[model samples]
Target: MQTPPSRAPNADQIDLRQVFGTLRRYAPWLLLTPALAAGGAYLLSRQQPPVYEASASVIAVDNDAQNSLINNTLVTAPPLPQGAVEQVMHSRSVLNSVVGRLQKTDLDPALVRGIARDLTEELADNAFTRFKVRARLDPQQRGVYELRARAETPQAAQRLAEAGVESLIAWDNNRAKQGVIRSRQSLQEQLADLTARIAATPPSSLERQSLIAARGQVLQNLSQMAVLETAASGTLVLVAEPVAPRAPVSPRPLRNAALAGLLALFLSAAGALLSDSLRRRVNGPEDLLPLGLPLLGQLPLLRRKNLGQGFVAASHSGPLYESVGFLRINVQSLLQEGKHRRLVVSSAYPGEGKSSVTAALAESLGASGLRVLVVDADLRRPTQLKVWSPDRLATHPLPGTDPALPPATTVSEMFLRPEAAHATRVSPHVDLLPAGTPARGGLPGILNQATFRALLDRWAQGYDYVLIDSPPMLSLPDTLAVAPSTDGVLLVVEGAKTRLADVERTLENARVANVRVLGIVVNKLARVGSAYYSYGYGSEQASPPANPNLRATRV
Candidate 1:
């Protein structure tokens, strides 16, 4: 007996049965959305365009006089000259310039955003987040440097690769020349000043000496600048050119779409479970009421029943009529062989359709050809007489019920009225008893005597079946006092509104008085999934159902 969602702790741990049950319960539309989403994903996957990518390599070296190519120490060490080139290759300036060369148009914002996201993701994932520049391990190619990049289309892949290599080389050279140009031009101006000063003044004059000293200082600076420039220029070298890519690095259409679909599914699943906490929706039987008793029978909503030769009534055709009929038949059959000729039908409370059910039961039994006496024993208020009318009451019939049976009290003795009686004849084979005069001693006063016992015993003797209509058990002592006279009781419980505690109490009262409860009759039952009548339809139920067709068969 696993507790269902409404009482289960934490929606995340919903019972598997509950999840599936909810799905099945809401199968029409709730199940449709996920199916459509998955199908759409699969369809989109098939239509995806293909892409290819290719890669090219470039090598960089140290521009030092100590080595023509970048030495192992210089290349591997920090602050190497080619480190700047690596930086330039991965820079926004470099990547933007490369994209410009590709001439992309009609861009999708989503695709562009994803490309930018994945580019950073790939670079970081490949261990390139921090600025890293190192020389090759092989002695043969000691001066090489590597940079990685990706693009959506193959042509874009190729152009990006070529653009990165070209950008690195050009930026490196341009940076080197800017410093040399400034240094050499300044030196030339200084030398000219020196010459002018020497010519204008007497030889070895003060001005000329100062000009000459300045000129020497400018020339020394130029020499140092030139050395630095030359070293910087030689440091970078290309070992290979970028090739036209055979595949695209982006879009990963299959994987990305699958992830999107999976996320949708997971969120949908979690939401379906958690929605209950937010809404407090009822989702299962445990939420409505407890269940476990063997199902007696499910009665459908009846609109009408059979119209026979002065035998059937108008109430027989409706849903309640059919339900009650089937229920009465089931209850009568359940009695032990030759026992329970008398039965008390009542519910935990009023408005459970108990009044109408009593009428339907009488009609159903009489239609079955059983000589059933329908007794209205609710002396507080009578209903059976209205349904079964134009019949007169008679003296209590118990003491004369059967000579062989122990003598029971008579109605006259119970009510202390000589005129107290057992029943009335509503039809040729069926008898009816009104709740009788409500003024004839309040409910308990009528039930606390021989009249009640005599009515049950004599009715059982005169008819093949005896059905006593009583008030709500808890509402009055009517049902409790009358229940003991019958073989057993059928507690009619209305689903959804009826609580387990109330039902237990009803049985408890019957038990306290030593009444034998035959079985329970659950009414107002709907199909498990919905209000649809899916079960017991079209199939040949072994016995004829208490239906209008009355394809009669013994239960």
Candidate 2:
């Protein structure tokens, strides 16, 4: 048969099962936040306006050809320059006209539902100009300028693009006409003056020849300017007309929802795991492994209020009874070789089920026909009397029942004393020594007395086993004071409630006091699964007393 695991778990070792179990335990919280986040993202997406885009292109005049035809004069300038095209397209006056035209169109209510009214007012005043329109030269075709516009609806975007294209053409034509007309008027005046000056000079004179040549050159220049002025009103021509887009470019609900949900899930799980790690509480056997003690047994969570009462009185014959029996066997196996029959049951704090476990253990041992004496050593807050009623003790005739019972050693004589008058036999083979009313001397005074150790020795000589119920180690020094004389200490840890640091501190205290720790009893396991309820160490068959002979040896 394989022995129980002797060494504690490595504190640094990672266990995948532990991770799964933690996730299972906190599944509700993990699921809730991510769902909420995803829902919120989807709703926010729905509230946003959809954006549509449309593009238009225009042909720009070649600067080199236009300038050469105009004789490169400052007055006869090129009709269009690439650098100035973008600036003129987005200029304040040009954009204002486009915005005014857009505001007049009947925009669809469903497309721009939330902000349509505000958008109309802002566009009329040219206030919503950010990224609404852009102008740039086409990369594939030189001298071709492209106009792009975005709006709440496809029709609105198309209209904005067309308006920008038309506005730039109108501005370019008006500017070109003014410059050409002014240059032509100035040249006509100069040509008339040269004609008058040549008429006044004689045909044979040197000045007369110079005047005629200048006049001829002026007329030739006038002819060229007149031809250039009538060529075209504007340098730019339409290449591609703006069309309504097929789809909106933004407000992707599915993608946003999925990303938000994943982010929320990661944050929630991380926070829960971090909090659990920092607390480091004993949740089950997995946590208790760090204590380096044999897991004698794991007790199920008991619902009965009087679990501290005798197991026989409670009529509990389920796994709880079997588990208690299991603990008794392992404890016997450990102590059978030594003369130390005393066992101290305690925990790190009050309400850890230490008192109830002590009572049940004694009752389980007695059921196997062993003479067991249970002492309530927690004088500060005694509970054994409430557990095993003192009234039950009165019903049993201690010495009258046993034929070989020592006459001088009555139950009352052995337990009833000036300090403890309430001790009595509550059941057959089992006795109770209640911690009576608080004495004039406190718990420290009572446990520290020489009589306490002497009394323990006398009881050991008479009873097969002596189980003492003591106060929590951290709560009071009573258990520590009584630990040195006991055979061994059994620490009781409540699952998911008792902190690991408290258990370690209690163990260190026992160590300093020279008390041998037998093992650990994990109580209040919340799981109702078969793994927690079933016994794993030994045969399911309940064994009879290995030694039926009940005579106690004198020390």
Candidate 3:
């Protein structure tokens, strides 16, 4: 499993399939997070108050009508440009005036001011709304402007637009009236001085005539100014009146939901990619691609609630049973080509489900009428014997049996004396050799002895299949030393817990011993999709409930 010396690093390749497979494995979270985010946005959007929009059109009018008429409408400088008018329409001063006018309605003034305050705050906080309320120049006509406004109600929106035009007109009228009043006062003062000068000049002098002519012109201009003030209304003329809208224009749920969904999707995809990058453990078959090992089978995870009851094949239904059957089938095919009958079960580390897989596989084979001998070779921490012979003698002797410290009582006694060691028959076709106790020389000394090899050979010739449950390959050297003597090694990998690098190291160790790894068995798989959810999707036998109590029926 070690990387080939000639091959480049794994980073050099872009494995999109593996990336997508990781995403698929975590699809529920990837889909749920985005859905929740979008749902929250939708709920928030729906809580917002509705908005009504209205527009009013206005045109710039010449305030100096009399001067224009006397001069035959000569070209004059324009009062304000379209850009300046747009700014004025949305200016705080103009909006304040509009708010004041709206507050003076026959309706409750407090309610009007409250809505106006909220709108003002919204416009101040949101740049979009600020620009939306501004005036726009008409494309078809020059010196024409469209003032738009938004409010909580149709009447308020219409009144706000109308108030913008009124404010402009009022401001222009005040400016014109002040200018006329100033001109009239100056003219009257000049007229009084000229008349006094004429009276003081006596007779008819050139200075008196010139003064009189200036005074008469001033008097005429004052009369024209007075008439101009009375004739013209204001500098701005209302071209279009604002009308109440039939429908509100805000709180657009559809648009808001779509935008929220897109945002959620972007964030969710980013999180998924980040998680995939940080993942270190193997989760499924795709994770085994780089290891170059054939996946023999996948056993569903036996939850803690389902454990402590022994081998998984006891119920003989569901995915665990089906997986054991498949493993046996693959082993049978390999054996048809003269493969070894002694299969050693080992894993990368302890608690990787190797012991459970060995017990279940042996049980499945035995049920098929094949004689199977399960040996607990893991001297460091043996488990097979405990599962098969729960009531087997550990320290006490069985009644009616040879009490002279029976020679073939346990596997440890058999290692010291193969001629006396006997296999305990658990079922009709299944037998077990428990690793009752370690010898004084320990596991290495025991497995390396000539007696242990001779006993294994003798059992290989007798039993149809010899399954040895060895200690974790990475944790101990017992499995590697005994693997060469066995037919093949079945590496067990726990899903989502076994690191790929650790499995690779374990396989490398096996390869160094020149042992053949039959295949890998991914154990403790979670039921996610249809492929793993159904126990017998295509089988003729109906699938039974999981964890059914065993009735000890004959196979």
Candidate 4:
């Protein structure tokens, strides 16, 4: 026999279909997170107090008289850089003056008191830390500055902005008058020294006469310096006055809510991806492709109420029945050319519905006019009796068996006494040998390799196909022990509940035991879109008649 080609490993790669499946499962949580975040942001924004802003504009230029004095080399002073205008406006002196003006006002007394206290404390710690009054220069027009102030009310904001402008102007004027004031002080000192020297000298000396002449020149220079000082005006000129604003600049609820919603959405998507990676499980058929096992069929998840009945293929007639029919066809095709007759059905763990799948497959095969036999091999926990109701079994005993003698009822009793064993008909063409009574303590001691294989050969001769329902392979050694005797094993896995690691471990155990795995049957899948099995026929309609031309082939 030729082996199937090996597929490349895709454990490290991400599948988009799997990602979409994960997102669909957690759709409600993803939608709820962003809404809650946006609502929280909106409420927080509304709680904040409103703040009003008012601005005043000014222009900086050189004082005409002072510029002339420096040009003529009569006074030496460094020119103020354009960039320093902002620094000057925010200086401690200017802010202190603004604070003083606020104290004298009667408008918004509570606001005035708060501003006065905060500014005083902030300035003492660091001059640059004070931010009540802000200064910014116009980028397009050089030497043009805008002074802004923020307060609790419109009237207080306007008052603070106007005070800041006046204080800056006064400071600039004082800086310009420094040169003239210094020159005047020097002339007055010279005049006073000449007078003292004349008083101290003899009444008629040439030195006194020269000193008197110098004193008159010094006094005349002092008078001219005073006139120059009076002519000097400040460089700063007011361009726009502050006015009360109509709207507040802060507490924008809509914009804040929008920003919060976007941030929350990104975080939720990333979290979903990370969580799916950590807790990876089977979501669809694509998740099983990495195991390198040929897929047999996919069965839709049945309602909880139908699970207790257990035989979905016989009792239900919608998607489950159609899907079982497809599974039966695939199994017959695989075993048609080989000498394989008996097969063991099992899963990685218990409660995966492996027993139910066995009962349904047997019923479907029997419906095709082939005699099928189902043996419940799981002695510890038998479920076939529950699946096929006890009342449905035929009362007639097997042919050629003595009616007066007692027949072996359970699989364990059959293994002990093969000659006395007998089978009971469950359906028209199907027979069931249930695991009569569950073994106490552990597995029955009669399950020997040679005895179990001999009994299977005897039971399989009367039927075309034999299905043995074994226990979970990973949980106990009974499945693996009985698996080597069967032709092959059928692996059953539940959708969205079985983990990938568990499936891999189960496959490894089967390989080590030298068991042939037929294929994987993904069961209990959620019917969503084309990912799961769905038939167009409605459940209310009668079952479609089977085609008479189709013939059952045997190996």
2 against 4, candidate with superior lDDT: 4
Clashes of 2: 0
lDDT of each: 0.55, 0.69, 0.69, 0.73
Identify the leading candidate in terms of TM-score: 4
Candidate 3: Cα lDDT at 318: 54
Model 3 worst lDDT window (10 residues): 546-555
In model 2, the Cα lDDT at residue 388 comes to: 62
Candidate 4 residue lDDT tens string, 82-175: 5566676566787788888887877777888787776677667665432443344444333667778788888888888888788887787777
Model 3 vs. true fold: TM: 0.54
lDDT of 2 by residue, 1-555 (tens): 112432444679875655665677678988999999999998999899888888888876444444564545323235454467767754667766666655566765444343344445555665653234334545432467777777777888888788778887777776766877777798899989998998898889999899888888888888867776765366677899999999876687888899999999999888877876887777777666767888776776765553444434432466676567667888888788655488999999998888778877887788778888788888777777666654434422232233244322222233434222223676567777767664535443567666767766755555788888988989888787887888888899987667788888888988888877888888876652344335533232443332222221111
Candidate 1 steric clashes: 24
**Model 3 root-mean-square deviation:** 9.6
lDDT of 1 at 493: 68
lDDT digits (tens) for residues 1-555 of candidate 1: 111112324556755654664445444545455566666776676576655444455554444447744432222222234345555655666545544433353345454455555546545565442122344533433456764545556555455556556666666566556656676687778778777876787766787787777778877877766665564453355667656566554446566556756666666666665653354432333433443333333433223233231113434443444444556567666754674388887878876656556666676677678777676666665666555434243323432443343322322233444233444555545666555555555444666666658645644665777777778888887777777767767666664446566777777887798887765555544423322223443233322343342222111
Models ranked on TM-score: 4, 3, 2, 1
Ranking by lDDT: 4, 3, 2, 1
